[model samples]
Target: MGFLDGIRASKSQSNNKSKPPNNHFVAKDIVFNVDYLEKRFSDCSDIVFRKIKSNHKTNKDTIVLVFTDGLVEGMSINDGIIKQINLYSQIYNSKKINIDLLQNLLLVNEINRSNNFDEIIENILSGNTALFLEGSDEALILNTRGWESRAVEESSVESVIRGSKDAFVENIRTNTALIRRKLKDPNLKVKDLKVGSRSNTSIAVVYIGDITNQQLLNYVVNKLEEIEIDGIFDSGYIEQLLEENTYSLFPQMQVTERPDKVCANLLEGRMAILVDGSPDALILPIGFIQLFQSPGDYYERLVFANFVRLIRFFGFIIATTFPAIYVAITTFHQEILPTDFVLDIAKSRVEVPFPPIIEVLLMEGTIELLREASDRLPIKIGQTIGIVGAIVIGDAAVRANIVSPTMVVVIAITVIGSYIFPHFSTSYTMRFIRIPMILMAATFGAFGIIITWTWLIYHLCSLNSFGFAYLSPFAPSNLVDMKDAAIRAPLFGLKTRPIPTPKGKKSRK
Candidate 1:
């Protein structure tokens, strides 16, 4: 048989109904006369009949038929739907059990809304049942959209030491509500968009209507509209689709779980998008400095916050360049080393046959492998793997002369520094960029390092997160926003938002 015939035959067999004359009959079948639907699906087990009693004894003549199962348990029908319907009937007793009256009561615009096919199929599948009557062409679309969901829990990956313990859950509405609950301003608007062609995932773009730029809002909406994917399971999907520079190692958008962090961004005039299934929300108009700033910073004293921020900045620098510096110094800048230190290094590397680059690569690769293995294992087991692997491999490799002891130290320090970054995405991006830096350092020493830095800066300058530069408050150097970027000055001191975003967003009150 042909394709249309084959599809019709399969649907007929599955539904146990004779195929209508036209190829496009099934859709129209639900649209035709209400009696045909009633007769075809009348005795279905999921169907129920609820009638109105005029007096103490039942009035069978003026009965309202609800083709759903009984409202109790062990039955497929829902109690809530029945309760709501009965409540409505008691309130509106004048509008008795009739087709037009029920239709009007249910606010159904047309006759097809209460048809037997749509009511029985839609309501039953949604855990309610079909509602039909002797003469009505319409049925009430009962709200039985019930499904179980998990409660919000603290974020395992982005936990803070001093900040709020509340984190996001899988529910987008709940997540948005959490933000709304915290910031009870009418101007804080959530624009919902149905993303993912298949998943139809509910995504909400949240921002302060007055504070956020209208141009930026339109840009973001246009970008979202351009996305034609089958599924967007996480915020990362939007990040990937909307990022200005996809090839750059640096992240253009910042994804976080904490509502406080998202709120902070919104106050800075940045837009936040929360996806239905993912706990993480993507914050647009993010800069390079944002990844370095943590939620704990604002929750602590300025002195301690500044000290911690400085440490993180240093950590990122050390993480990116420590191994490369080791390779460069050992291979090309040996003359710059102190006499005793040079002798010690020479002694350490004497037994190693491979060059310093090769030695560094070996140790770096081993550290990366250990890190990956540790991350993939369970918490307890992952800790064990990290400890055992670091000790056994670092000690064994050093003793075996597979890599120099100093090189092992550099690689370990690099790995630790990468972990110290506040945002996981930034840390991951830094981890990836490290290899290229190492290669460049090995090829051309300090000059190679300089070239890499210059190239990175160029890329950063080119990168934009929903029209706002990724290097904002640094490249443009906004003195006003600088207080909150490099260091958490004081809660009161942050009187203005990041300058790259729309102005007047930040507040002292």
Candidate 2:
């Protein structure tokens, strides 16, 4: 292992410096401290430590600079640190070294003193230069953290017609800045913590202090603190850990790459969690209806937004129950169909050997497989392959009597409805559980579809996002919240925030 306790597997021997004792404090002897660090970071080639001897009227004292390579900009080191320190001896000539003098001479924006090994190691690894004086127990940590990162670009996943073009990159500081740009309120609160004991990845919690509910904020913060994972590569990990219902298929927290969406939620009294190295942010206390909402909903006019929301609601119903209903009606409740349309469907299925349920399962299963393959493939070819592949495969299957023509229509419409969800993960829930719903319909007809949805609603009611109801405004039925639930009211009409406002901030009445 290297400077980080469990980072690397390489090790080497140092000739003059044995490992330091259990006391992990910096010693006044700079040579002893340098040897201690060199031994700890034995095999780490990226860690750089340079020894410098300060000029003195009588005797010279040594100074050591330790920093990680590739993280600190060269100009920052050249113009800022090295040039200033090199020019120090010509300017100041003193017998006794001054800690305050050295601190003042450093050309860095931020500097902090730390006497212990923990702080020194942390700062060095976090792209900052550590200054260990010859005869001082404390070292100064300089802020030279700069590196090349992907520039902010249009969101590829969450694109919109009328909204902010910029999206969050893999940088946490940049992500926070994006959120800050949207809401410039003094009440906005941002907190940072380190998770993943092995990785020590940075995580941030963002919310409006006065508008956000204290209990809700505490629940989110506590849930995050309780996670004891070795590493968290993405916000998805934080989302799962913060979820109240671990077994539920539905996502309790909404994940978005758009800063506008996050800011909108925070203004609604919700909290968001952003993880370092991950582009997505997790919005908490989300409900079932939010899956259908998009950032464009607010950007567009209220009349148009209301109309689009209704279409989404209809799409959800069609996606969840349409296939099951088709299978049930054709298999058990055929009498309900119109006589002429029934004849057309019967003629189409004359060559098909399988039952309606089996045909649907086979078609739906094939679509899911093609969808997965397309996703795993490169984006350039994936979209073309998915569209052409679905059409070709469906036509061939129908021609070969593997599935009925009408069955292909049902599955295609179901697939379209599945894609109607604004959130990709939410769309997956429908694609994932559609087969089971079809099975129920195959077994017990319309009654089975009724039973499955009824039980599903019950499950949704039982689930909670942090402490708030998952099916909020619908199960509990708040008319005020209803103004923005399935329909978008005018801006002035939505005076009340969607989430519960913090006490004393605003009266619900």
Candidate 3:
């Protein structure tokens, strides 16, 4: 009780932190301001500080430019900004330095003046050059944000047979542009946000204005505002924070790199979050069935799409429970198997010393290790390792009698079935839970598998992502949403948008 009380006290103290103090306004002394900025940015080698004068001998006052070195364009600062400032100062040397006068003189497109020191520092760090004058208490922010970024290409992870080849880039503006290209309607709105008090990373909350529920928008906005953290480097961070059940193993938000996928979700009254440094966007209020969806599902013929969707649905099931079923039947439910099949399995296991569950685990662990290794290796080498390594290792294990031939076949099918889902997160969840299901099956035969699935169903039905049921249109049994869940019921059949959009209004396009 004493330790628990201490923990409670710590939590209370953390929650009672005072609001941050207001930032001091920029001072009129150029040297003093430069010294202060340099002190704040101490040890940061990339910070560039330059001072220029209109006439070195004539004017006693000078202008100071502060920015991050690589983040800004040297050409833009030299030709566009610095040249114009100098040209203006020489022509009007008698004129006093002021925010208004300098604003008219600068040749920059995105310019703003701020007296707050915090804003100035933020602009400089964000790749904009900050201009400070000798006699003015305000700084001019000249936007010259630029840096080499990965070129947008078809997402290697979420690849499709048919769909847009372009994916979201790490840069937020570039990603927003991709979304804009897909959604040209005036109703499409993007709200710029800042998270992570220390990192101050930019986030773009995108939604379709008129079509999206206002209440849902407000809830999402409020949730974002409530976040207080040191840094948010990826959309995954935001996804974890936004989740109502942080303890749940299942991903509460859908992550996608394709901009078209974001646009489609937006049209359905759902909101998306795009973080600055992350290429993936978070699609909220995701249902379990939504995890099975692919962007290509809607691009192909109805027959083809449904056929593929069915394969994925069944494949996921087989991947998740096939090994467990095998273990349960061979260990305790052998009477349920045919005599020929039992004989084949018994014959295969004659040379093997381990039980069915142990055999499955050994094979599964080896496959998982190989999969993880391939992911961490270089692309070309990774593919070779995944294919060649699996074949070589499986063959060696079978011959060495480390595992039975039948067990090897079961594990192989399970691995292949798990690969059907386009969403890697969902695939990972299946892999994560498979071992537990196998353990339970080994203990309770088929009863254990039944118990595990029943609990999963109940837990899924109980869960919601921002108030949108995880097992939507299934547990709640909404016929309207069922058309798009497991089956791609013709494009025309999906006439209505998602009714529930993560605490959003029910009405949608």
Candidate 4:
């Protein structure tokens, strides 16, 4: 059979099987519940089940506390719950203990009551203690979550000279608290949702209810609800699924580690998504120009920030087109260069064996390897490795006549230009586009470069992020929004939010 036919047959067979129904009803009998739970968690050694028996005035009562081994707080379980229960039994002389009065016995701050067995199991897995009484069908979920996590430290990737040093940690609650501490408005809302069928990862969607567009909010929430993945390890997974176009290389969502950045975006009527295990939070409805912006832009003086913004734009152009332009000029349009420069380039290439395209590809590939090595290595050693590898490789290549010295310079400048991008993803996207640009330049020279650029521009114009145009203020030509696009207008001069905001809510007041 053909490959397609085999795939179809396999899918059909898989679809024909009868799926088992979920048996998650809570039983009134504690013994039956315990047996079911024991059977469900038979092979799991980390799940702890502690049973306590209380005898008060000839009446015997039993309670089972379920929690994960290292996830729950030790003191909360030992002293707060167990010790308190024993103390209450000894002090209060009652024949029958009421299940409703159990809340007063436990010393926990946050206690919730639920009768769903599935919810009880979920709470236990999420580092909470679940108490199942002998007579009652309900279970009490205690907030006993306590796990070791890295402390909030300064962001390494998006470091700023003059700004808050605190960055988001892996814990979702801590990340939300960081943003809450910044934006104290009552309208700021945080809604929780669960994604990933197997992983059951918790995600928080945060936004200001007063200023945000209701339709945009609904779009984001619906998109998140539609995710049917088995596991979501990081925010990147949700970002990809939430994208309007999965095939596009450009990211529709902006991921940031800084709480300040998230707060700024939220204040502007954008939504922020925080996943439980990822420090990176995603900001939705982002435009292309916003990706080039840095949190430090608003922190610095307007004049200096504007100058830096201009430099970044220039770097973007150079990183994307410098190598391609050089290849097209040297191979197809040598007459464009001055007499001295042309003679110098020709002299450099005299001993080289490969053509311009091969030379460019080889050098670019070597630089990429060095970058990956540097990134993967230890901090101190990575810097040393990057410097040594570049010097040794470039010098050796020129000496061996494997590539021209001019080509080495062009590749080095291209790498530097790519690094100037504040966002690593944007830098990566630029790096990826270079390959096609190089191939086009090698095949059709100047014409190919022009056509490739025109196609890229058209694609950008057509793209959207959460129903908002990706290249807003440039494609649709909104002059009012351009104040913060390519240039950094003074803080006082800027009074309105950018494009794609809620209707009748344009001013930043």
Candidate 5:
């Protein structure tokens, strides 16, 4: 069956099941609201409901403050809210205590009225205090989110010697505040979105309202809204779901932990997706070259930055093609090598039992295994394992004649080159691309390597990230945008934003 047909069948099957009864009870009397909430939270041991009573001459009223224990600050509820209410009740005489009067009398900064029981529950669960009063039909939600979270620290992944030290934390509001701290423009917009049906994960889309393309904004929003999932644990999950090409090995979005990086992209007319509980944010409509750009590029001198960028590009080429080229040249095109080099290689391999392809595969697999092992182990032990494994294994292989020393050097260079990439996802993609190239080279020599390169370039050119060309400024050949592609030009030299931006809005000025 087709994709749409399958979806229809699933919908029909789901329709057959009885729909869940709506639990959205509106707050009316205090007794009914408290009883319903207590019943709903019967299993929750951390739920706290504090009752406060106020007596004025002939009238007596009760207020219940509901919040999740350990999720809220006790001082805020007691000193800031309850204490002030009690003081006001003793000093003033009132027969009716309305939400407006309570809000004005309270010392809290944030207060909103809501009658929906679902909203009240959600607020309480999200570290907010809900105040339900006797004889009142509305509940007030106070912002008391004081949950423990890691303090902002320098990002280990995207570290820069001269850049801002503060990185995004898991808290969504704190992430937004970091971005706002950098870009104080009124046009900076933060739109909240809730994804994941069961998790109800909070996601924020941050962009400069005036500069961001409306079409791109709409596209991102619609795509996010279309997502139907059980939960979203990280920004990575959202990245995968929102990417235009899921089957491609190349990443369609850029994931970053630095708020400065996100702000820079937003200024460039790009939009950022920040998911709650994820330090990393996803940047969209990103070109392939962007994967090589570092956050430090803008901090250093233009010449030095451009030089580093060129080195990264060189490393990318070497990482992806070195193994395949070495295999093809030594195995099939031996005549292309100098006589001395050829003799030396032959002498080295004389003691080896496996062919060029087999030697390459075996060494590559061993290196990959060691690399993965190191990554999975503890930090100190992982480093030790990688060093010891590489030195000991490479030396043992050479002594055993299972692989040549020269082959080991080539593979070493390939692995080291892959590490030069700024983005981990790009490095991973390079690793994946190398395997296919290696296989093709083993089968068809240098011609196979060329064929693989051609196919890779074609695939990259064909892909798009949110309608912007993936291999942009190269395949489409935008000379203006090329200034920042392989090598970045001076900051002042960049007069216009990247291509595919809203028409007439391309100029950065």
Candidate 6:
């Protein structure tokens, strides 16, 4: 009874948070006064301010509009707005006006009056203008947001050899347009959500209407609604927040810079999230096979794609476990190797003071250091670092017998395998997972390696990305989905979607 009571008390206390309760706040309650708003936002480096005054005899009101930096270009006191203000002034004075005047005075700009504080702030942040009337409590917000942004370039991460050259930009609207340009169906829906308490990043949830499962869409929405963070710097923040397991090292949400890749996921009935200020968009309910897939697979010939896929799959295994397997076989099961090969390996290690595991750790660590340093340096310097570091370090270490020449070959092959694994993010993940394999090898040799592998499989099986099983179309066995998983079948052979969630009303046509 006491344990249960304690648990209930803890839950109650957790529910009573210190943050502001979620509730409806009216316009008056939310908006700071125009002057206050300016003062508060003036210090912000990104805020832009504009002042527009009425030129009519009756109305002496000044419109103070604020927007994000560089979003609004030119503000003109045009005839339409001036005429509308003149009529409003006359009405305020209880003066008689011509009946035909209403049509000309009633402008399209009246949509601005419907703006509440939240809407005004939303518009302002999005690079739109928020207007403040001197006598009125409501502010007129205009949507004239535009700014200089980096032009769409070839995707840096998911570059295709033969497909589209255009990649997603930092602008959310432009990114949506890129996808919309490719997929021109009206069924493609984009739902907007404001994430991040401080950053207030604009995020768009996009999916095909008839194809996507409603239950899964609602689940994603509910998960996003549950987030209470102050800021979301990247798609990674939302990924971690919405994921089932916080402790898992494996990424549940897949991010891609390519619009085509996002379109491909949407066609498979998965949801895509586009965040403002980020070129990369998150694809939910991604399977392990999806991570291994390259956009190049869909662009090139089937035979070429299949060959590439096979190489990647082989590379995956070699990159992840080759070092561990080598260490295990050499240290504990030397009989597995040929007698001559064993003799050669033994002779190579004669001058080395460290054990096999230490030699591997030293070599792998140096390689990683060189790789990281090269990435940070300028492009020209980066090449220099790679060439000079690899050549000088390998020659010096092998000749000095700090590490065996055989060990050098194994490490070099492992590094090369990691680079060829299609997705750099997944390759990085595998690289991180390699350390544990090395540790396991050192602890209990072959048995430890097997145990580690089993644990990894169990964890992968347990993982669910946005309610879809991570190891889908493999662990449960879906024949139709398998056509594009391990091997790339011909385009005509793939006649169905990957089945991300439960079957909906729409199937592949």
- Alpha-carbon TM-score of each model against the true structure: 0.80, 0.92, 0.91, 0.93, 0.93, 0.85
lDDT for each candidate structure: 0.72, 0.82, 0.84, 0.86, 0.85, 0.75
lDDT of 4: 0.86
lDDT of 1: 0.72
lDDT per residue as tens, model 6, 328-418: 9888989989999999999989999999999999999999899999999999999899989998999899999899999899988898888
Please report, as a residue range, the 10-residue window in candidate 4 with the lowest summed lDDT: 14-23
Clashes of 5: 0
Inter-residue clash pairs, candidate 4: none
lDDT of 5 by residue, 173-228 (tens): 99999999988999999999989887888999999898899988998999899999
What value of lDDT does candidate 6 attain over all alpha carbons? 0.75
Tens-digit lDDT track of model 3 for 405-476:
888888989988888898777888888778889999999999999999998888998998887778888888
Question: Which tens-of-lDDT digit does each residue in 1-509 have in candidate 1?
Answer: 74223333444555433334533212222212233444555667655434443221222113233443433232223234344346665676555455445445542222235434533554444344344442343455544333456688888878888878889998787899899988999999999887766666778999999888889899898889889999888888898998877887877788898999999888778789998878999887888888888888888888998899999999989988888888888889988989899999999889989998898778878877888899999989999999998999899998888888888878878888888877676787887778888999999998889999999898888787776767877877677767777776677787876765555655741
lDDT of 2 by residue, 323-373 (tens): 999999999998998999999999988989899988888887798889999
lDDT of 5: 0.85
Model 6 off-target regions past 4 Å? 1-33, 42-49, 58-62, 75-111, 134-137, 501-509
Superposed model 3: Cα runs more than 4 Å off: 1-23, 89-98, 501-509
- How far off is residue 409 in model 5, in Å? 0.8
Q: Candidates ranked by lDDT, best first? A: 4, 5, 3, 2, 6, 1
